[model samples]
Target: MTPAEVRARATGPTAGLAEGYAQANLIAVPADWAYDVLLFTQRNPQPCPVLDVTDAGSPRTVLAPGADLRTDLPRYRVWRDGELVEEPTDVKGHWRDDLVAFLIGCSFTFEAGLRRAGVPLRHVDQGRNVSMYVTDRQCRPAGRMRGPVVVSMRWVPTALVGTAREVTARMPAVHGAPVHVGDPSALGIADVGRPDFGDPVTPEPGDVPVFWACGVTPQAALMASGPPFAITHAPGHMFVTDVPDSAYRI
Candidate 1:
């Protein structure tokens, strides 16, 4: 689907759509908070890899020139003092001249590679958003940013675990490599069938739960820090960029 088409619906998740294009997570903060977020991302690259940063008050990104950040994504979450206020299809109503939007790499960029290598994503097959969980693990805090690490989980066939890792590792900018290969309990995930964000997908008999650092980690930090105002893509609804998946693949 084209980015414009995705923007029009503005209510569905972006998973299993826009194949071959790189997807990104959006985080817009007031100019005063941009530096702290920048430091937070730099200190925790695994979960918050920087893809592009727009100038304060500007909604256009270099990653997808001509696309409007305020309306290009399928959905957006508006936060006030760290609390979710609304899930809007477009954020033009909330746009501010002092907001700085950050586009972060998303693991969706590597899903095509996994599929090409014969790894199946159960969520995609089931037509559900990928499972995400907030772990007890704490990210290295930067300035006012501090929160538990968040991860997206996929059930991979046990035999293809190695191939999955190798395929994803090539795209380091999009959260390459699995953080945990099995046993969701190890990551403080109580139940694989119940996720903290997005819908859950059951694991097959030979499937092992694999976890990857998620772009949602920064959102968790933004909430914990209680920023006055912030904007982010709703979990699983990413901004599709014009860049191809191959551009980020090593």
Candidate 2:
């Protein structure tokens, strides 16, 4: 990502310009509440798939050892009192000595699986972010963290629907399965043209919309919790990890 672009997202620029390695989602919360949030994650494994957790007051991820959470993400969102107030690329200025970092699995980790299976992604093709929505469904709540389940949607050709499911099902750490499929209204989505978070994609004829348990689910929970402070990787931005996809393969 360009400096100006990362600045806009406030998550910072993507490093290791050459090879595209693994990337994880970064969620930062106050140390006092880290235990609660970590338990929430453990309870909701699929939605808050934890890759690594930093020690109290540490921003460095043990899994991605040398990586720095404060400036590694291409974008970051700062939430205050349950409402988002800032979307910065880096959280250095906002970082606190009491902060705790959690590296969670990201959906981007499975894009290659979808591509290998030959399922077309309209969002990537059209240069738009995947569609995401806030569903009527509620997540397994934990202390101060509970709310509607948020999901990301991708339209796939009817013929390739099975392929999409098969490929993605292999990576549960990264939203392992489709929570819902085919109907948007069933998920409380009134209009596919305008998504709640990311850009909407054109759903062509013979394409079925598929939804995945998005990493953003935690963000939704954070919003509901309205903890005094919280941080997350911005939409489309992620934290690159050192692990290989093969390591997570089933």
The lDDT leader among the candidates is 1
Q: Tell me the tens digit of each residue's lDDT in model 2 across 1-250.
A: 3322332343332322212344577788998789878988888887788888888778877666666788767778998887899998678899988888888886667776777778877877776777778888888878877877778888899998888888878888877878888888898888877888778789889998998887788888888888888899876676777776555557
Best by TM-score: 1
Cα lDDT over the full model 2: 0.76
**Count of clashing residue pairs in every prediction:** 0, 11
TM-score for every candidate vs. truth?
0.97, 0.90
Candidate 1 shows a clash count of 0
Cα lDDT computed for each candidate against the true fold: 0.91, 0.76
Model 1 per-residue lDDT tens digits across residues 1-250: 6755655564677876778889999999999999999999999999999999999999998888868999888889999999999999889999999999999999988998899899998999998999999998999998988998899999999999999999988888999899999988899999888899999897789999999999999889978998999999999999988889999989
> What is the lDDT, from 0 to 100, of the residue 68 in candidate 1?
92
Q: lDDT score, residue 164, model 1? A: 94
